[model samples]
Target chain A: MAQQELEPFFFRSGQEQLFGCYHAPGRGPKSAARKTAVLLVHPMDQENIRSHRAYRRLATQLSGLGYPVLRFDLYACGDSEDECELGSIHRWVEDVAAALKELQRRSGLSSICIIGMRLGATFAATAAVEHGGLRGLVLWEPVLSGALFIEDLRSAHDKMIRTFLSKPRSTTPDEAGLDIMGFPFPDRLLAEFKEMGLGQLEGSPAEDVLLLDQGTDYSALAGGLEATETRLTHKSVAGPRIWEEDPSAGLIPQEALKAIESWVAETMP
Target chain B: MGCGDNALKEQAVTFGAAAPLVGILTSPVASVSTGKAPEIGVLLLNAGLLHRIGPSRLYVKLARFLARDGFHVLRFDFSGIGDSGRRRDTLPFEKSSNQEVSEAMDHMAEQTGLKRFLLIGLCSGALVSFCAAGQDPRVVGVVCINAPGFSHIIPDSVVAQVSKRQASRYYLQVALSNPASWLKILRRRVDYLSIGRALWNATFGRLQRSKSSASTAAPDSVAATHGMQTQLENFKQRGVRSLLLFSEGDWGLDYLHCELGKSVKQLEQFGAQLEVVTSADHIFTLRQNQRELMNRIRTWCLGLS
Candidate 1:
């Protein structure tokens, strides 16, 4: 089979210019009825770098399966211009909206399926709620609560600091507060983020919502979505968090890919 | 004059300014047999936000290895960090301005009388060295390991903006609960009272603007273009070679390589040799990797002739 062609392009969102790479299938349907587009929203920062190869793989696979895929850098990240100017959930949602519009313009596809990891998933969910026309939502290890995510970041920062200090550092008083990589939390972003629980979004019923949790149970997420009248299908895949820089990290979860490909095939048809 | 083998002295020096400049200075075990062992010195810099103390297994190993390989090594804490002074209240990492870094270089030169000086820095420190080297002609060469270009252009305004943003968010939340807080703020500024308020507005304003326009109006014009550009130009003029080491696994490597590639391309336009090493983390932590890095450095330094 001939390989698909991936084209790199840039689009304007407000005053910022966003970068994206679009992959189109070689043997896919040419008619409007068979055309499909998937937008791959990447995790923030280091995870974005670590998962570059995996994301490329997924984009290729999806394109091969007759779905055009678009992977783009969020604002202030990758080749995109700006320096994290849009630190709020709303601003990121706007970026996602811009990306979707751009995808429609470029590929002539009216609908988009969003596949996101971590905070990217949060953005995708917000976009889905606001736009009301996504084909599917694939969330891999999605962060459900901004407060909890902040706590995790703080813990990681504290752990790193402790390891560096050799002597024990005071952690009790500050444990509750969010401090990531020695930077204090931005309250506006934090407050807005706390309101971004995935279970709370009001949107049209998605064609399918696939939640892939690695090394932990996602029953709560599934239950939360169910309560909100959102149909969610959950699965757990065992693997190391390759988003981290550990050399002995595990490979990308096979089940995660299987679930994604299967969903693309079923949804596209 | 190199100390005779019988008259060699080895010691650790903790140079004190308003801030302590803690460093380990190593010299030959013996006096120079010939003129002076061509006094070559290497300074070590750590990665982003990491202090220059504790075990620093990679740093220590590299320094010791370099020292044994016959290069005098001085690894010190950057200001407001590690054993150095408290963090500077400036935007960006300008604890030591370009002038100050040059002064440090001169001081090191005067203290050691070393003919050749090499700076080996990880991440932000590597970017700092690039800026510092432009100002100081005494620095013969620089080895930047996994440098991040993101923080390279941090301006005082940006730093102040970050702090101000934090303060505004804190105060804004308080304003909601306490009318007195709002009253106080209103009284201070019928319009706007604090630097934080101004910064918060500015940040959003920047966000609201198009990225293409923002790129043209970068936060720090001098630091972004002139600082590194001037340094590369000056290094070329002075015949100082530059080396960049990047790793596939390091988070910041790709961006660093891109920035370095741009700088190198600009320098090459002015006639300069730039060597790029493709395998090494920000710290060159792996034993085999460190050795490979050292060998590459040695070859580059030797090839400079």
Candidate 2:
């Protein structure tokens, strides 16, 4: 049963106009913030677009369970800003902060949990380190090594070109850097990603962190927080790689979502 | 709600009977050379299940480009797609999609006070916009990219089979031409599932398809062509300008040329433009290709009467 309509609006993040959706708690309003507020940090580039259905479904499901959830598009993504070349990890981190501020404004600055996937996991991890102190952190397939992530993107992109197209666009890293699917990542941005990694984090992303394993091992990076006294739990979740093209596959991975939902519900203090 | 000092703003508006369908409006920040906003509105439709962002967020880039150039652009998710909610009614996707296009047009008419709109869509979105242009008098022009359904209605299996055939051929070519491709196969860099599908489709699938085609000539294919002919006639009667944009060598374009060429070619007499982007895929994923596509769209829209 739906209690209220989802609120879709455009908000400002520094100089860019970013698009975001606010899912009001299905059973209750903002009355429950610290315990039920969830902010989703989406994956970047084409991965973000492919995983959109999952994010919307997750938001709806969480809202139904009485959590006010927020889903936002980073700059140069979704209904946000347009230029693909303008997207950078730094700007995306700022976008996360702006979205969190908006979520906090609605939650009266209460402790809000953050759920991130892929590249977004890196952004959330970095944001958590900078912002300091969060209720919970769900790092779903976090990119532990930025260089490895870029290589993965490159290989996937090569496969995409071979599968769908006869001749691909130039990828010599000219002014456009390289084309991943249709999104353009500049060389400087790619260089930035190469220099960053979750292993480089000196502090914990949150007091309690749930790392959903999507076939990627994160124990070494997870152990990096041993000195910070952060509670870390690793859960292996069998879910389709929604980032890849598989029309027959369901967009929402039920098992993975259930694990997260259970973690959020049980993690509530 | 665009922020900052630019005269342009991205406004969020909801329309339809319950005002349930949501759309984002991107408008000019300042008056253009003519000192006022462009009179015609550009309405973007969702490409297949990809939502309003267009394939690879092309619609977003296209929207901002057009807005900055003084045209108002509206991108919205249809009901049950993207951020939009499901319709209370159980209308099939085809009928529901057409209805949504008309509703979007109505919304545009109300917001811009513009009587006419220029519509653009990709794949199935293109089909929806074309159908809407045939029905909605408010549509003066439409740009359809790799639209389907004009192609004969084949079983879903055949679609998958075609994909496998392409993959198999591509793999065969790569395996023969490049030593690295075989190295990838040796290391299993190329997924086994993909190879298996390709082999299965190339062998057993081909035999099955041949036998199936011998038994069935796709009875409705001719009827489908005739139906498209009538629709093109309707478009002409309504003076709706149609632009058929296709990627060279795409299956959709192949189907168009193979099955519905005669009917589609007839539209050229009435200023219906047909363009094929060289070296482009179904979605024109390349920046140069997209620029060509967008430039073509911009020129056609601006030059429209």
Candidate 3:
């Protein structure tokens, strides 16, 4: 086994300073040289905590396999020096672009791969659409519909309200309108997210997209893709939903990690 | 609009003690007609990674609410966190000890001349408040909202699993490094064992009893209130009243509530009041709900005074 080393780095996005941990492989053969550097984007809210160790493990594994990996906190997240209110879809996309550029700069790698979980995946997809030179993409249960996700969050919020109120609260999404996760929703963020749909985004098309759906089916998202050269791969793993609150019950499927590693090995130039 | 007319006057101060705590003090913007002067004050705690900024809105709103209801409020950054220049780099929360918190309470008490105090802690702040309540007599009451107790209780079995994982990782790293070093590290493994124990106790000890009851189909409120009762009793021995507030949708509380009822029932048994605010997230960000919750708190604190 080779000694592994990690370097801490910071990049600026607008006025906010974002923090990242870059992991690089030790000396290796040139023929076995890794082509793509990966940027690992974490999920939002409590999901960040739940998936933290797993994300670190992913980064470690990727680096161990001779690829350079960078794991960063979104502005207002982790050790980043910005307020979370500074976290918007546009700002997050900008942050990803900035991170990708920094990853390129630090690794001196030509093409890059993005591996994002949940909301991070949404941002990666949006970024890849606008920016060129992405070698591949890996989305772990990407949020396809921001509006629907927000609606679910709102529904959860409403349920909480009802439970607290000790009265029946409206359950119908139509009646409740578009409010999720305790935050009021207009179409601003959702419209921007909807526009970045994998099928609609413009680029050389994602080289390859590996969607790791925990419980939900990704058929619709897979079927909707119009990318001429892009390959879509979907895998469902039986593990605990990392985003949910129960830590004891949910298991992080080993298959998911294996699939991810396999995909990276196959796709990397 | 003037500072004189404002219900709370804000000032920045620093303590010259070890670790040198610094914070903002907000006194009643206006004097009460009774001239009784509030004897109780509040210390606001921040959410994760937010420092004082996390609690800025809550503290401002709370300060006004409490001040109008007749209590002074102090909102300050923890050392190395927020605006405070010191960070708890090597010291974990338990080991960093409560030295900084005690100084903050002392400074607030001395400045305000308030004989009684209440702590409003969110997330990590809640843990600090718990520790502070244990150490300070001036802290007569506490309201901990959405605190995870510590990072140990995210899953019921997380502590044990994490401990095992950490031990394995440590041993594996040592084994891979050198066989002789592995033996050397094995001799000192007791220290790591103690660290694991401390981590477990710090993280899971707070939630274990309640979690066990929750798993057994016990009412969540009962279990939660029981946990609160024990915490409040610890506070009560020091003359501190306890209030445990949880929002409806907070996923953290979902499991506990399911297993515990409202926990309020248990809190009342310990002479601590528990309140549930509808539609409020962990931080009570919703404008209308925040106002309502603040009003309820004002009424409660007023009754206490």
User: What would the TM-scores of all predictions be?
Assistant: 0.47, 0.87, 0.52
Tens-place lDDT digits, model 3, residues B1-305? 11223454545556634344445565665554345765787878755545442432455456645665557777666654433445425666554536666666678767867667787777667766766776667777777676555222244443343344344433443233455555766787546675556556545654765566546542433444455446667765665776666675444444334433345356566556656666555666454555566777777677666
**Model 3 Cα lDDT, one tens digit per residue, A1-269:** 11224555456777656767788764544325787899999776445545655676677678878888898878666445432343578888888899998888899997889999888888888888787668889989888876566556666665444333222233333322333432333445456545544445545437788888888877777765434467877788876666654322334556777789889888784
C-alpha-based local distance difference test score of model 2: 0.75
The total number of steric clashes, by the backbone 3 Å criterion, in model 1 comes to 11
Give the candidates in order of TM-score, highest first.
Answer: 2, 3, 1
Taking chain A of model 3 alone, its TM-score versus the true chain A equals 0.80
DockQ of model 1, rounded to 2 decimals: 0.01
lDDT at A164, model 1: 25
Query: Model 2 over residues A61-168: C-alpha lDDT tens digits?
Result: 888777878989888777886566777788888888888889988756477899998888789888888888787889888888888888888887776666544565
Candidate 1: which docking quality band?
incorrect
What is candidate 1's CA lDDT for residue A135? Answer: 75
The digit string of per-residue lDDT tens for model 1 on B1-305 reads 11112223223344433344544454555443333354657777745534342112345445544554456666666654433443334534554545445545555677777756777777777777666666566677777766555345655533443444434443443344456556766787434556456556545734543443334434463354455566666777887767766554343443433234334455556444444444333444323444566677666654542
How many clashing residue pairs appear in each of the predictions shown?
A: 11, 3, 22
* B-chain TM-scores per prediction: 0.62, 0.78, 0.68
